[model samples]
Target: MPPTEAADTIVALSSGRPPAGIGVIRCSGPQAFAAAQALAGSLPEPRLASLRHIRRPGSDMLLDEALVIAFPGPRTATGEDLVEFHCHGGRATVDAVLAALVEQPGCRIAQPGEFTRRALVNGRIDLTEAEGLADLLAAETEVQRRSAMARAGGAFRRRLDEWRERLLALSAQAEVAIDYADEEDGETAPDLRPAIAHLRQEIALLLTAPRVEPLRDGVRVVVAGPTNAGKSSLINRIVGYDKAIVTPIAGTTRDVIEIPVSIGGIPFLLVDTAGLRATGDEVEAIGIRRAKEQIEQADILVWLGSPCEKPAGAIQVASKSDLAQPAERGGLRLSSVSGEGVQELIAEVRQRAAALMPKGDELTLDRRQFRLLGDAEAALTRAASLSDALLVAEELRTARVAIDAISGRAGVEDLLDSLFGKFCLGK
Candidate 1:
């Protein structure tokens, strides 16, 4: 989609294609009601679904029986007059409805994310809330859904508003002090140093909190070990599928095979890598190099080995335990064949992953918001050190601008395009 204002009525399959019981076609713009009336014979009352016989305009040929709902301007999702057609879940039926709407004078197909973009532009939601909505749509696990729900529910935005309000108040206080420093017997400015320090401390705490990005992108757990150590078998058991090929032959698995698995409601990327060992084959050598690289990037490394060969500093797992007793006393011992201690291993991994998750209340800011917050924190930190009210006020203004950027109060036109571009069509 191009970067532009929504000048025409837009239509899209808000509910995805057929095989289900129903499909919804959404239209929003100044002419939304006119377009719906053109096809449905007459517009339904606002916010109420009315059964209608949808037909082609002029020819008056019946398209399908549908439930049509109309919403007048400023109260709808996009803050524009909107219409929805709930029709039979069939490709031909949906296409015919869309075709009829587009044939009208002012209606056309909506671009990807155009609907939500309209919502943002119309003051229905902010950028942070929009991001949360995107996350909610993409969430696949319980934890992801909970986090995204918190964000979309405006919890995170309310917190940011509090912080922004504080900074704005402080900035205003500093400006007032500067304005009256020369006045005779003027009221003395409140000491802002303590307030600046408190704000800095709060921002620092938020910055230091555990990040939730791993929840959005699953936590990576890499299996590293020498050849034929049951790494593939162990991962297969954990994921409950043969995601990786298990063979007794050395160097059988070459390349990184990643499977997503959820343990204890935490999502994880279970990576089965090529065994780490010196290999004569060129392809096997490349795979071994990639395995080492995976180890470096992994959040948790499960070093699968025999009783005597565990590596240092990894979560040691004694593989093929049915064939040999555990060499180490504290490490998790498991036999993939017998399924012994596999659950224990999973529990351990979950504990570690949970440790890495951010607090439930902390918002997962995107890269732009993170950078902006960091800048605000830095500005506040600088303001805390200065005794001069003018310099401190300048720094406070900088911090205020940074905070405002997060909520789209200033300088974010290009960012809006980038953010809305990520959204799929019909949302």
Candidate 2:
């Protein structure tokens, strides 16, 4: 049934690209039930899947036989009437069904993230949950999935709601105090310093936590050593494939080669760099310069050079250990060909990388989220120290605005387009 005539009904293939086992076509809005009824002739009971024949309007041309489910308005995923068609996964089948649905009046193909954008607009899920859904869709590694799951479960939104409630209470107190400043000595504003101080301390601790970037993009582990130190071979061994060209000759790898791999559920990028040496070739010099830059940016440095020359905190490796007798060294001695100590070195890198990620189910924040929290924390800090009720109220408002921006409750109109753009069609 149509909820309203103003809103456009949207339909999209919510499942993966066709040619799979099944395709899920989702429709939501006021006209969703009408469109579904037009094709199926009769609609199924809400939330119950019923097999139906999908056909063109005013014709007996069968589009596809599909299982259909209807969801009535206001409690659905988009907070509107919704329908889904579980149809055969062939491309032609999906295209034909979609054409039939869109041909109905007020029906149109959904834009990327439109369904989810509707979910956000209609108050079904907040921005933090939306962001979590985005991350879940794009997640390629185990840890990333875990982090996104926690976020999509509304952990951040729940916490922010608590904070927003307290802010409103404090704001009301400040208003009352201002309205009766001279007239009522008996109606003193409750001391908000205690709550303000406590809130600020909690937010400060979160500000110290790891950023979400390293988890999204794998942690960088750059391999650096002088020429012919077996840097290329070592990386190929760790990555389980030939990511870099290997040769006995020095200077063969005159550039940086990066390979991304997941170890023990954590993502890592193994970077093979040009051998460091004094080279007259302009190209080799440029490669060396880039290698140095990569080293500076590395989260973990694997040094295959002499132990004494290794940079601070580098994972020192005595390369080509198969050809040379084992040396008495505290660090690792590895042979890429023999596979000795390769797993240990990899374990070490993974251990180091784990510390940089969001710890088991910790709600991590992105760049924008971290910045907004920083703003809110600062406002709370200012509010805690102020004795004037009016000034404290002003600071609390600032904090609330910052917090609201995160949940898409206020001041987030500009963010919707860009944020939803990241989502795939039908999300």
Candidate 3:
């Protein structure tokens, strides 16, 4: 019996790709129980796993013996009835079980991020937490993982909750101030200045915190310098691999090659560009142009040329120090041939990278969250500056709306599809 479309039961293989030792097949929604029962015969005790013979419906052939568990909801992951079939981790075995469940009324395959999205829709989690979960899944470094975990664990949600409460109280106080403006000689007017100031200060602090994008996208470290200054050699040494082709020829590297590597737990994109010079060759000239663009946008620049001519804050490296030392011993002294000063150079890079990174699992805002916080802070600033009760209350309301958006309490319909699309189908 197929269940109605309005009450569809969703099923998916929740674990890693099959052909492993075990695969977890999950089902949720109104038809979860019926779908699981159709395959496993009967449900296990709530939250308890029990062995059951999963078989094809209306057929005598047995499929696989699996451990089955059920979670009745408003208390489960999705806040709905959910069930899990721990089947043998074989592609065919898992597929057979999924087919059996889909045959049940109202059961169908889950879409990408459908499970987590349902959790969000059902009030199990807020937007910050959902974003955190997505971050955790896509994390490529330890810092990224820890930061994502903090977000997924509701750190931002709790912080937003606090901000929202303060904003609401301030809003109510502004309203009261307006209502009782004539009654008392400003005695009844709750002074919102202190609270508003404090809240604004906090928001400002968060705005200054390290952002999540740099951690995810990696620090852009561009290696640039004059012809034959060992630019490629320095980058290859830094990354400890021959990512950039090393040759004595000045124009050997005729393009920008970016190698993403993690150094001392920090993500860095080591970029090797064509040696800078007046080149007449069209291809090399184009590469030089692209290199200049990369240099302009680089977070860190390893310059292997004259220190006086390097970009602002660029780390000048006196490359090929194995030979007689260059007169200009500026920036970090490095010799790729003798492997000297490489560790110190890397340490310097890490020191610079640390300033741009979030410290040890601490929460850092994404671009969207940062922008919203800025709006809330701006509104609160206006509220604090205004003496007119009517204007003050209006500003407070604006602040409230901005704060509400931090955790997705207000309009965020456009963000839902983009955010959920980042997740894998099982998530």
Candidate 4:
């Protein structure tokens, strides 16, 4: 069912700018089909395209020839009567069509993500799916696309549904125990302790889902080591481009050079820093300081040095291995010149970065969403540890509310404002 006609009708250019061959002007609400019919001179069949000459409503002035399509209530993108006018992709033509839409009764400009927000508010999509739609818009890699697809496809909902069902069952069992304990015949039911324990374990497992934020956002890998260890060369090798200067001279890298690269389906911001060494030259000392700072800030620290002693901490990599094979202390050996261990280094980098990240089920591109999940998880943990059944039930209910906030099932205020605030208009 549509929202109780509380919101006004909204209209916007859905296809966006630089109108290729066509631009789509979309409208939805109680007045959607009527608005379309008023401007387009009768409705196109629902969900089917038809040619129509769009003109100013009540005026014979031709605006543009367009393919008009109508989607009636409950079958449309917003779960309302939605109509789209595919006009010529010119800025003027699109603007003229939008002008026509606003002239209709009860129509106004669509807010940022208003269309998807409608889908959310109308129960057409949950919060995660709504986030997925936005994530899809900004996805830049295959891994990102897959992560967004999972969220869009109700992975969060599936997880929550399982948790909610378990909680509900436990609550029901607890209630039955309380309700029927006084009965003379004494009704027996499943034990509450095991059920609660099982629920806690499942929740914990979900809380530990593979973290995909780096993939969803981007991963940062820093290349650092003593001078002449081929840090810049290793960077170029990993990026498959000579992005950084490589020289035989020590302290060649005196400043941090960061470049964004994609590797093994993951995005990487590769940082090539000045060699780390106890330097006498002021400039070289500064570079060493900066290198240590970059390493500390990096998502994955790649410590490159001579093929001699392995670093006590950090992921040690023996760069310039073509000269001499280094002792392996569960270390990665690589030769930027020969590409030795480059593949292994890349895999290890991604694996280590992923290990430090939160799980995929917990991977929320939206920072606010992740925080909410964390808050809810904390509440759930506290709730699960309570000995009192009623308190546990209350805490579980609170946890469910937080989960719904992420799912957008809680009808949060300013949600559209917060979401669309970040988007460009007419998107």
Score each candidate by Cα lDDT: 0.84, 0.88, 0.86, 0.74
- Residue 408 of model 1 has an lDDT of 75
Regions of candidate 3 where Cα sits further than 4 Å from its true position? 1-6, 140-144, 180-188, 222-257, 271-298, 301-346, 411-414
- Model 1 pairs whose backbones collide: none
Question: Model 3, residue 380: what's the lDDT?
Answer: 84
Instruction: Name the TM-score of candidate 1.
Output: 0.72
Candidate 2 deviant stretches above 4 angstroms = 1-6, 182-187, 208-210, 220-265, 270-351
- What does candidate 4's lDDT look like per residue over 39-74, in tens digits? 889887678999998888878999988999898877
Which pairs of residues clash in candidate 3, taking residues 3 or more apart in a chain or in different chains?
Answer: 2-105, 3-105, 3-106
* Maximum-TM-score candidate: 3
Off by over 4 Å in 4: 1-6, 165-190, 222-258, 263-265, 271-299, 302-313, 316-347, 350-385, 411-418, 423-427
Worst 10-residue stretch by lDDT in candidate 3? 1-10
Ranking by TM-score: 3, 2, 1, 4
RMSD for each model, in Å, please?
5.6, 5.9, 5.1, 6.5
Q: After superposition, how far is residue 117 of candidate 3 from its true place, in Å?
A: 1.1
Per-residue C-alpha lDDT of model 3 across residues 260-345, encoded as one tens digit per residue: 99887778888899888998999999999998998997878889888778889898888888899747677777899899889988
The RMSD (Cα, Å) of candidate 1 is 5.6
Task: Report the C-alpha displacement of residue 303, candidate 4, in angstroms.
Answer: 6.2
Report lDDT (Cα) of residue 391, candidate 3: 93
TM-score of each: 0.72, 0.74, 0.76, 0.69
